[model samples]
Target: MKRYLLAGLMAVATSAIAAPPQPLASADVKALVAPPAKGIKVLALWSLDCAYCEENLTALRAYQRQHPDVELIYVATDPAYQRDALEARLKRAGVDDVTSRAYADATPDRLNFMIDPSWGGETPRTLVIHADGSRKAVSGALTPARVADLL
Candidate 1:
């Protein structure tokens, strides 16, 4: 009887362990990557204090300036602190082709899985999904030339 009881408890615990963390299940990262229905999709993720993120954002900023037709979508991991700042900075930089959006820890929006399965909420990730569904994903900082080359 004790063995059967233990077995039942173990089964229940194992099922619970297999579930996605409660905080992550509701994340909106899954839904946030939708194309804006206008131009090429440039989905960029960043953290407020990440040096590499800042560098990548700078590169993107420059690229957007040169390629006005590109649809530049910005995603920040530190949405609370950097979203507004980023928008303001970009605006000041004459980054008119860009739009910034943020996702909380528990929203249904997430990076479109077409980009990657291992992303699991990694910041500084980007996917350039051309209007044709052809894609290029950058997992780290990339220079403007590199971005242009990807294009």
Candidate 2:
């Protein structure tokens, strides 16, 4: 009886593992751990392989046009999982070497460190902070209305 129950549990776990990850959206790719951006900070944690992330790439470009001084950032959660794809995605997103970028684990403790502990390493997270030290965070994807609230 125990053996049968164990087998049943294992089957359920296996199916769960096979399930696809949630799609990342612009809101999801928006921020993870968000350190105060000094001026206006917008943190986005995303990947190229994620279709949901692609949706927000367009908004990011649009944001750049309007908020030139808003410090936009991207943190590639695990580059090894999507290195080439990430490169292509960013390039297509018009995000380049000159653009603000970081690796979640590689970041030192001095700068954006506080955000790491806060986010608990979740991807597709977002945080927006104003120069006056006001801040907001959204898990999953944030909408234009949400972004507007922060501004």
Candidate 3:
């Protein structure tokens, strides 16, 4: 019976693995904010170990729930190889369903510069991309005002 129970637990654990994120290359960063953006987009950058990243992701998820029109995009700063942990965190934050991507480039700085020149390799960086292609970047935990800024 103990062996059967252990096997069952292992199966459950394997089944609980979260969906892996898509790869985000530096070259594709501009496409997120370029023309034909269609709708308001919230691009959230985070990592597995970021202190405030989960809070920010939860806040963004809540904001997205309130305003369904806003597109939510999650970009994990961790490499694609760490997709398991990244996706697990996103699942816990309840934003896993939104478009998700992980950094595929070897040079993290290049990806950061492509996303936003002003970004200084900070975690929990959030960018509000307007339909008109203008972008507003905020670093740190997201607040009500920051969520409103997406509009």
Candidate 4:
């Protein structure tokens, strides 16, 4: 019983050390969309309340594992106040290692517009940005094949 308790404590401590999602403002969003120095950058937008977001996150985690060189950025569409919930979901998905951010602006609509003028404010939205700053945006849950094709 003591050994089990010690192991459980250690696990909890390890998880606590994992970085939590940062707050994302409109300026941050603009910076995120910029092209990377090398390799492709994947921006995945999700929400704790969206059922499809979980599935998409799982697929993204698997894809990241397969292609370690790809840059994966996860942005939780939930308000900044729900940071705890967003972090919990990211932990559950085993994706806390990736760069994570939560929408922080009071006027999220404006932020959404900045992200993409045509986007319908949907969860599970994905943007595959190339090194040249060009990108393809997809709105919906992504499958393994879809992830592969995007990369």
Instruction: Write one digit per residue (lDDT tens) for candidate 4, span 1-151.
Output: 9999999999997777577889999878779888888888888888888889988888987898888878888888889788888888888887787788888999888877787777888988988888987888899878999989878
How many pairs of residues in model 4 come into backbone collision? 0
Which of the two, 1 or 2, has more TM-score? 1
Off by over 4 Å in 3: 1-18
Candidate 2 clash pair list: 24-52, 27-141, 27-142, 28-124, 28-141, 30-44, 31-43, 31-125, 31-126
Report the CA-based lDDT of candidate 4 relative to the real structure: 0.85
lDDT, model 4, position 19: 77
Better of 1 and 3 by TM-score: 3
Measured against the true structure, the TM-scores of the candidates, in listed sequence, are 0.60, 0.56, 0.81, 0.86
lDDT of each: 0.60, 0.54, 0.82, 0.85
Q: Which stretches of candidate 2 lie over 4 Å from their true place?
A: 1-38, 80-83, 104-116
How would you encode candidate 3's per-residue C-alpha lDDT over 77-100 as one tens digit per residue?
Answer: 899888888877877776676778
Give the poorly placed runs of model 4, Cα more than 4 Å off.
Answer: 1-17
Which portions of model 1 show Cα errors greater than 4 Å?
Answer: 1-32, 35-39, 79-97, 107-116
On lDDT, who's better, 3 or 4?
4
10 residues in a row with least lDDT, candidate 2? 18-27
Ranking by lDDT: 4, 3, 1, 2
Q: Give the per-residue Cα lDDT of candidate 4 at 104.
A: 93
Angstrom error at residue 90, model 3 = 1.4
